[model samples]
Target chain A: MELVKRLLSGDMRAAARLITHIENELPDAREAIRLIYPHTGKAHVIGVTGSPGSGKSTLVDSMITEFRKKDKTVGVICVDPSSPFTGGAILGDRIRMGNHFTDKDVFIRSLATRGALGGLSKATKDAIRILDALGKDVIIVETVGTGQDEVDIVKAAHTVLVLSVPGFGDEIQIMKAGILEIADILVVNKADRDGADKLALELTLMVDLGHEEKADQKWKPLVLKTVATKNIGTPELIETIERHLQYLKSSNLLEINHKKNIEREIIELVNEHLINHLLGIMKEGDFEKLIEKIVEREIDPYSATDEILKKLYSN
Target chain B: MSYERKIRILVAKPGLDGHDRGALVLCHAFRDAGMEVIYTGILQTPEQIVETALQEDVDVVALSLLNGAHMTLFPRVRQLLIERNAEDTIVCGGGIIPEHHKPELIRQGITGLYGPGTLLDVIINHVVERVKKERWKIA
Candidate 1:
């Protein structure tokens, strides 16, 4: 409880401890978060989604450096895929950004998706709230690009930067509509490569064609080129993000998007909570007779559903 | 007499290192030896790691660091465990840990320093023997 209080007061150590508790899925951790949930939602959530080896981690490291230069506190949640057999994640992304470990202003967490779809962990949304409550100025959620599921999950961010690198075979194949529609900014990283210009041009053409289809929208997606490893063009990329944030605020889309995110979070929370509760009840043998009746064909699945709903509602 | 419960262990990777094949394989070996193993996903800070070990109430905290941040990360983790009153939790480490660094790691109060090529059974036996001795002393 004292630690939870400390976490609420923006203590980095306490915040890190709380994140570990959540990652380990400790039952008491949930209660701790429930106590701190009211203090969250102030930080800007940025999602960086891209294919593996597209320099996403390097880009994140560079962006954090830029944010620090401006004296902004940043929190990064890097998601890695888990090994199904061992239920452990091979989190190697931090190797690229190890230099920032000593920065008290920066908090980096590596998460395993735990086989969750959408490239986000089941606890990721909760972890973001924890970081936001700790008063991070910018919270970056870097997802391992695993196609459409990842792109869909990143839609929660205030801004999503879809990263791509030069010489990646068939850029068109990887740039499916699921990702194309969600990217707020398109970054062609590794700009020093020979094909970088060609990739950027192709991306620009795609964005232009995309805007033509949505004529009513005023803001067009901006394409930027960068070499993430060398920290080249990263400052401009951060500026582009800031500009996008301002635009969203002035255009009043910020509130609209924030509301949608809140609605989604609440729906998901309640849905999961109710399912767990129902499962507990069922495990208590509350559904045995109903299951038996169904097995005997005394009730159809539709009737069984109605029966279960009635029992659940009566409680 | 109450049966002695199997010792639980939390094997974690702290910091931005992505090499975890060692950690995963070790978890399996521990499980096969009838131990309850909780593997914290990668890139954990020292605090996240200590907290998980406390919550799990593990008998040992075994960490695998291959990213060369072991010098900085391991000591902090050892200190945190001490602060958390988990000093009795045997802290061990393995992974491309250089032979030259083993003495320093042991000097920092790490119980054991395992390196690549160490047998799984050797680590497990050492942990079980040490934990049993500790429990016996407590009793």
Candidate 2:
């Protein structure tokens, strides 16, 4: 509670401590989230995701500068890959965005996926909430796209920018329905390279064709090209992000998205709690015994689960 | 019950040093050792390093300076951390620091003024042991 109070009072130390608590899955993390939940919903959550070598980090760095030019306080949650061998991660977001290290308005933190399939830690949402409560005007969550984790991570954003470099192989794979459904803006980074125009054109045609199937779609995703390292087209990218934000507000989609996000979070929390509680009630020996029985052919897993469920409800 | 927290280290390159290969290698080393390493890339002012160490609440602040500014830069960070009442954070450095300056640097609160040829295992052990002693101290 003191941490929450200090966080609400704009203490960066307290905010960092609370984030550590969340990351470590400490006991009072739930209390901190409950206290800070009401103070959120103000920050514009933008997710930038792309394949490795797509210059997403550089793009994010450029976007941070553009956001600051508009006098907005920005918080960045950069998700980095964790070592599968050691269960550790190197958070290198600061390396790319080091110029803003001295800027008080820009607070950047790196998160390890920690083996989370969504390219984000489970505590990422709480971390975002803490920044939002601290009154950040824009919170950018950046992730490296590999699979479903990227898609899941982008769900936290109001505007999702999917970046791709030329020659990433198979434009059709890039324009899959799952990817297209999540992208509010498509970017072909490294536009100075060869095949940049071909890549952008392919993406544009895909977006246009995708829209024809969903006739009721009001917002059209704009495919843009950028050389993120050179800071080219960043202003236009920011403008497009702002436009999307405005569209969300004017159409009242912002409130709808907020509600949907909270709903998803609650369901996840419920599932987590239910499983934790059930496991807590069942002794380790009993669970292992069930496994041993299945191995010995005395009982199938289905019946073992049924028996456990019956015990769970009976007492 | 005291909860065990991850050892977070801010591996920073202060001053005009542009060679980040060593700093990045150490970042990977610390991370592989299971400590969270926040690398403050290159060309960082002392003020920026201290600020990041404070905000990140890191257990250690390791400076990697190859630009011959260790005496001026390392002490500046230690002083800032002291002024901010974060004296508990272990301050250390590596990267071409001369032997004669090691004593003064340590006297000024830098624990590990490692130079070239210091093994990653040694640095990792030093960090883990130093953090254990300081973190569990009954203040």
Candidate 3:
């Protein structure tokens, strides 16, 4: 609780230490998070995601600059993938955001996906909460390089920016519907390339096609082009991000989003506690034996679940 | 409580060093070794590197430079770490240093000094051993 107080007082090291504790999932992290709960939901959380080599980090770097120029304090969580073999990671997104290293107001932390099939680390949501409590005006969560299906960011972010670049593949790859469906904005970064216009145009048509069916949808996703390295079009991109946030505010969507985020966190916490408690009572390898029994056809999977649930509820 | 912790390292190049092959190579080696490496690309100032080490809460700061400014840059990074209350963060260097500078560099509280052709595994082992020995942070 003392650490949580320090975190609320904007102690950077306290925030960092709490994040690591959450990342490692220490028992105390839960308690500390409870203390942090009342202070949550202040900052605007933006999620930036894209495939590898699509300039996600570079674009984030530019956005940080734009946000800083507005005198808004920013916190960045950059998630990179951990090796499945070694469980090690090179959180190299900091390399692009290096210019902000000495800026006191901008706190950038890198996270490893740690084998979480989604683009974000398990720690990301809590980390965002900590920064939001730390009084950051804008908090950015940059996902690990994602494929088309990594849309979990939609749950964690108020606005999601899905980036694309040319040379990734053909037009069909661009027209595909998974991540594109979740985008509040589609950014074609590295837009100086040969096929930049084609990519943006294709994405625009794809976005427009999706809009035709849901004409009542409040916010039409914008298609923006940016050369992040050269700082071209970044100002407009960030303005669009802010615009989306304002739209969320003026409409009732911000309240709706806050309600959804609250519901998601509670459900996730309940599920985590249920598993931890159930596993705590079971003998080691007991679950494996149950699996073996199912595989051997001695018991059905539903019965195994019922048995576990009985144990969970009997006490 | 027994989760395997990831050792975070910041591989940085400071003082106008354009040649970053050594730093980049070490990033891959560190990643493969299961450490979380934050590579701050070339031309980083000591202040920037130290700031990163503090923010990322990295266990090690690995500096690789080819600009013949190691003596100034390495000592300065160490000093900045001390100034920032991060004396526990290890400082390591790999560049074009000569034998005569080794003692002075060590005296300045820099460790794990290496030059070209030194096996990355040796550095890896050094990091693993050192980090493991002091691994009670936030436990």
Evaluated with lDDT, which candidate comes out highest?
3
**Candidate 3: where is the Cα deviation over 4 Å?**
A294-300, B135-139
What lDDT tens digits, residue by residue, belong to model 2 across residues B1-139?
2333678889998999898888888888998998777886788888888878866778899999888999999999999889988898899888888889899998997977777778999999988888888874633
lDDT (C-alpha, whole model) for all candidates? 0.79, 0.84, 0.89
Per-residue CA lDDT of model 1 for B26-131, tens digit only, reads 8778866766566666788897777656544567889889888888888889999889666877888887778788889899877667878888889988888888
Clashing pairs in 1: A91-B18, A92-B18, A94-B16
Task: Summarize candidate 3's per-residue lDDT along A79-173 as a digit string, tens digits.
Answer: 99999999988888988998898899999999999988778888899999999999999999999889989887988999999999988888788
* Greater-TM-score candidate between 1 and 3: 3
Better of 1 and 3 by DockQ: 3
Q: What is the TM-score of each candidate against the true structure?
A: 0.75, 0.94, 0.94
- TM-scores of chain A across candidates: 0.88, 0.95, 0.95
Candidate with better lDDT, 1 vs 3? 3
DockQ-better candidate, 1 vs 2: 2
Worst 10 residues of 2 chain B by lDDT: B1-10
Tens-digit lDDT string for candidate 2 (A1-315): 899998988877788778878887888988998999899889999998877768878999999999999999998888887777877677777678877877888888777777777667776888999999988999999885555335876558899998888887777676565655688999989999999999899889888987899998878999999998899999999999999999999999998987888799889978878777776788779888999999999999899989888867976
> In model 1, how large is the Cα lDDT of residue A51?
82
Q: Every model's DockQ, to 2 decimals?
A: 0.14, 0.60, 0.77
